[model samples]
Target: MVREKFTHIYARAADRKGGEAELESLLATPLSAQELKGISDDRWLSAFTQKVFQSGMSWKVVRNKWPNFEEVFFGFDIEKMLLMPTEMWERKATDPAIIRHLGKVMTIPENARMIHDAALDHCSFSAMVADWPAEDITGLWRYLKAHGKRLGGNTGPYTLRIMGKDTFILSHDVEAYLRNIGVIDGGRDTRKSLQATQQAFSEWQQESGRPLCQISQIIAFSQGDNRL
Candidate 1:
């Protein structure tokens, strides 16, 4: 099984790095259910927007200006964002507080509407995210891509990880590892590749009793980078 290959990689990484404890240090602890529930929907929106803007830019830049982004976006209030005038958004294209890219600037309202619609249907965006089964977390990624604007590719999964969801990030390193082990055949983001990755994670979870986040980090760590 793929889990055995991954375990061997982990063992090799542990040996090179001194011990299993060092490998553990490279992993981030996923948020508990209570912790996840405590996070507000607005915060989820902020996280989503952050990931969207960080897509092709330096995350450090986005992170550094996040406080100003919070102020300019009206604290990411869903309703307010949904109703914000076009002129304000246009004006923000020149704002120093946030990334001034017009295209990225435009996604704010569209994504806000996406979050608003999800909240309308599921009570709250946070609730919708909190309710999805972690075992099929890739399905959540699919849902976000289909329903939310600018949430395609790894953005949705990364956003989920940022929100403390027990999800995996199929980063290039992880994908390469999967391909090397034959869990997947190519790097294409097609449904087949996604399903293969999802099934592999499912098996690993059942075999290891670990969340997708930790499994993903382990796979990355197994590659000897240990920086996930």
Candidate 2:
């Protein structure tokens, strides 16, 4: 039997998705803080670059060429990436080995610089991210957007989650659910809307003790015509 209280969101999602077990299986777990802190800086830079390239492109295509990207980028070594000359970048752009978008290729150096700077300041970039409170994940989003190139919108959130940070992406379904429930209004990226969405998620977390990732997923599953 489902309780009809604050946890109705969980109940509704479970009901629509077959049962609680099914819903649990559908949710992805975020990496723990200590595990996240253990990830190397180069891997972080590599993941960020991958997501940037995949943003508006075919994920399959990008994935197929990822090995070349690693080779060309010198395994995403922070110091080596910083030392890569502008002319080398141009040559790499012309290489058939990887996706040759100059603008996107150019973004890598800037993001690497940002990550390297964080590493210098906080002992390691992963440490800084691991230390950040999940309750204000949006602050981390804003900081990354202001500091890193091409990291605004879903890019930063997506990369953070991929790197094991416990954050949420405002996927279309999640945005639609937020709006339909009046937790948000107008543009999903607006400050007012994000604040409202954050508050709602925080309240839900308090009640259910679920990670923000799962809560975000549940909110999306509980709404629209997703019943199955």
Candidate 3:
């Protein structure tokens, strides 16, 4: 049933009339944040390292200093990071070129270790995601706790949504981003947001549903790279 709803949304969003062109536009022009997240394996380490640098700093500052972070962090190579000597850690802790928060600066190694552990247990860092179920947002929160996610807050769940790990309806950013694209209003609170998402899903199920493959084709038509 949930899959049906997802299929429907993809179909409608991927409608062809304006979808293809809009998708082309988005594919042609990349947003900075989007580009950062989309980094390939060759640069994934660099991107993740950049994410750590921004942990306690404003995203804006992190954005501006991304190049420097990449350079100093050795392009995000996990092995290199894991093997970083104590002296190098000290240097980074005081480096004005990076975010200089003492605690965050120091915890980089520990955080990397946690990520490595998660990868070992789950086959990939992405395996950590199975900690949460997709159908229930609240359950997802509970799952995070059980799976050893230290940061637990409303914002944590929202972060999961933003990171595309969970597709719960409490996605404030998705709601707001969709609103910006004129799909839904931004003023809706969490309850209303979930309701809207539920209704949309319900509606899609009632219509003839498409599979992930065919749905991809329709999204190619309707959603058109608007990233909706």
TM-score of 2: 0.94
Q: Which candidate gets the maximum lDDT versus the true structure?
A: 2
TM-score per model over all chains: 0.92, 0.94, 0.47
- For candidate 2, write residues 158-202 as lDDT tens digits: 999877798877988888767667777687777777777777777
Order the candidates by TM-score, highest first.
2, 1, 3
Give me the runs in candidate 1 sitting further than 4 Å from their true place: 1-6, 224-228
lDDT for 12 in candidate 1 is 68
Instruction: For candidate 3, write residues 1-228 as lDDT tens digits.
Output: 232344445446545444645544432211233333343332433434455555556878888987777777777556677899888888887888877765655555654565566667765444455343333444545544454333333444434434544343333444443455444554453545445544543344346442212222333344434445
- Which of the two, 1 or 3, has more TM-score? 1
| Candidate 1 per-residue lDDT over residues 8-35, each given as its tens digit | 7668667766789887877777887767
Give the range where candidate 2 is weakest over 10 consecutive residues by summed lDDT: 1-10
Stretches of candidate 3 exceeding 4 Å from the true structure: 1-56, 130-132, 136-151, 154-159, 169-228
